[model samples]
Target: MPIPTSNGHASRVQIQEPRTRSPLPPSSSPIAFKEQQGRPPPAAQQTIAGKLSRNLFKGILFSQLTLISLLVIVLTIRGLILASSHHFHPKKWYPPLLASVAVSGVASLAWQCIFIYNPPRAVKATFWLTPILTCSVGILLVLIGSAVDAGIGAVFVLFAITQSLYGCWITPRLEYTDKILSLSTAFPPARTREVVSLSILVSVVYSGFLVTGIGGATSTRTNLDLLFVSVILISLAWTMQVLKNVQQVAISRARYVNFAHGEDMDAWGAFRVTVKHLIGSICIGSTLVPIIVLIRGSIRSVNLMSGSSDEVMYSGADCFSTIANKLITYGNRCGFVHVGTYDKGFVEASSDTWKKLRSTVGLEKLIDSDLTSSLCFLSAVSVGAVSSLTAGIWVLLIHKDYALEVTLYAFIIGYFVGRVALAWIQACVLAYYVAYSEDPQSMRFDGTIPNRIQRLQLLSARRDNRELEVGRDRDDTDNC
Candidate 1:
């Protein structure tokens, strides 16, 4: 038993060691090993507290869409009620409305800069705030028109117009390439980038419309021509936006289809096809519709100039501007819903009174297309019809009496109904696109992103929490 000392015996007997083991390949390095574990390395996970602080600052106001919507609704409702019951003068309404537009538009523009300039992690909050502030401003402007002066409100309308164009440009730029390629029906980024660039380049050209409208209004002292110019500007702005929208949507669908089929190569190919189609569509569809509208408007403009029942022409012009403002305000607020040719008549007819000229012209017959293009066609017609009808309503309900009471009641009843219907259509269309675009396999992805709205809020919350902890630690350190 004493002699059975195993460790001592083994040490004495086993003198030779086995050959040393070879190190792993570079691909199997320790850094890679940790990455395989599904977590970022410690250095990667670490971030500065300033990031959270910046996010908290940016997102404090913009995170809650519900709150923003409620605020807008409340303010709009209050203004409408006061205007209706008190019969406030046009001067009073114009000032407040202009103030709201200037303030909100400026705020939104500022926030957009924040999103671009904020610390990396803080961007979510900055981006979130932009739309809410912008929307608040826009809603105020629209409501203001009903309260006091639709003519003056036309100038402020450019804010929403510019914002939409900016969104289409920036969102596509920031978003994933795959998403852009998938959604686009044309040159995808190339065309989008061009549109954005061209808009910036031609800001002067576009601004000419505003200047002309304002100048014409001043020189002629005619509300009708002013309204006509505003209406035309709005129509052109929307047409530009929608042309880009169609390209985006087409590419999106094509990319989604390819991805869904598990054919990554095919998906890219499909995206290319989509891009081409989008270009053709924009050339064919977008340009064509607006041109027709412009031609008709031009003819009408000529007739009015030639002394065709100046009252009726001006009345129609006012009608055009009012309805255009309503549609632009509401349409921009709502998601992009293009009610094609068929829906135009429905929307036009929905108004309390009918336009004999609009009805007799039968524009639908000339521009009507199938259901796939239904949204585009409808969008053109619906925008025209809606703008015309709302203008008529404003003249009938408010301008004639110099009070907003009847207009407010009509807006409350009509606007909400229009909103609900529009919202339903938007929700359905968006849902369909989103659902259809998703791949069942992609759904299983560990890192699949959530909705844009949700993602921004979560990022903001996380950033805020981090900042609070850092602040607390800093305070404790100072105290000690």
Candidate 2:
């Protein structure tokens, strides 16, 4: 029963496969019986509607509306203060703002189309091509940035190079390459158009936030102005995070409705559920991830820029912050799956999600996509690098002083767009995990994974047995 695994060790893993079946031998295929069972459980019913109908706003007053109010207040204060001055005009934001919106919308739709056509290829290409694009683009930008001295050019180059190298290093080490590749396009493709439109809507709203962001960032002068700008940027970032999470909730709901309840729920219908019932919980859920990320970035930036005498302390702080962010982000994602599935508060949903994951597949199996995650980050950074380069070049040509401002805006917008494009994969994964956890033995969830894994196990078993036979022959020779 012991089989060598990818970790180069043998373990007695009793394969839960090769289930008893009729008409054909069990040796024919690893998943012959269960693979044919594709329909949802008979137990799933319309009672889910009753569970979903309740008003489940957990923290609207303190979380979602508060971010909205803060953004408005900061924007109003900035507008009033700058009413008399011609120094920082919103008119200057027009071109880059339009550019960001257009790029974001087009890039998102295009990426969605790519996935629609071939999910496996898209996933594979993202892992392989994004790194090359990132490295190539990084080197090009580094050359241009060094020559032109454009402000955010240095940041873009560094991000590109770092993300590219990380992606290249991680891809080859991925364990379940075939499993993830097959799982990539396995979702029923009924929910494409609505999600695409929702993304477009998010991109437009994102541009609105960027407009205020563009104005505030370029207009900071006094300490008060700086405070106002920081609040505005942070609030905008939070809103952007909320929008993405909303889509995530919608995708989970859509999958649940289609598969579990045997009903149809398009992106907009699921969006309505999210906007109606889950907005407040989502707002609360979205709050910590972005805030922690902002804090982590601020810490890293401070440490890197300080050129601190005590490198040890700075290094420790940076590592600590980064680890904390990753832990929180991973927990938050699993938690949101529970939130989307049931009408529970953020904390309660997240708690239940952990219990379910631990009891079912364990945390290691669910969150072990290091290569996929790295590729996504690198792809987003690559998009940001392209945006930064294009914006920087234009700004340097026209008005070099504000080149940093425009490039930063472009990078944020481009990165957001890249994330939006990749959102469906994340949504499918979480939804699949939730569905699988609900009915582990019988759930018709991602059939491809089981088959591929069975094949790997068989191969590993054969390899291990061969090695044992060779060892026995050597021992016999030594005895003779």
Best-performing candidate as measured by TM-score: 2
lDDT of 2 by residue, 1-480 (tens): 011122111121112121322232222222321221131111223254323432233444346446755665576567647744737655555565556656656656666655545445655666666645544444444444445543334554565566556656755445454345234324333545666576767666656554664465456466766675566556555666677787777776565444333344455555666676667667767775556545655766666676554778777777766675455544456576656655465656666665665565343343543245554555565565566556656665666566655666666767776676566556666665655555555434444445444655566689999988988998999999
Per-residue lDDT tens digits of candidate 1, residues 1-480? 011113211221211121322233232233322221132111212134523432442243234323433433443444444544444443433332222222222332332233123222222232333334334333434554554545323433454355445445544324422221112221111132232233222332332223222223323324664464355444434433433434333333322222222122122232234333223222233333345445555655655565443687777776665555343222221111111101111122112112211242321121121111322222222222232234334444444442232222222222211221122122222322332222212321212123433455566689999988988998999999
Q: In angstroms, give how far residue 374 of model 1 lies from its true place.
A: 24
- Quote the lDDT for 321 in model 2: 63
**What lDDT, from 0 to 1, does candidate 1 have?**
0.31
Model 2 TM-score relative to the real fold: 0.66
My TM-score estimates for the predictions, one after another, are: 0.28, 0.66
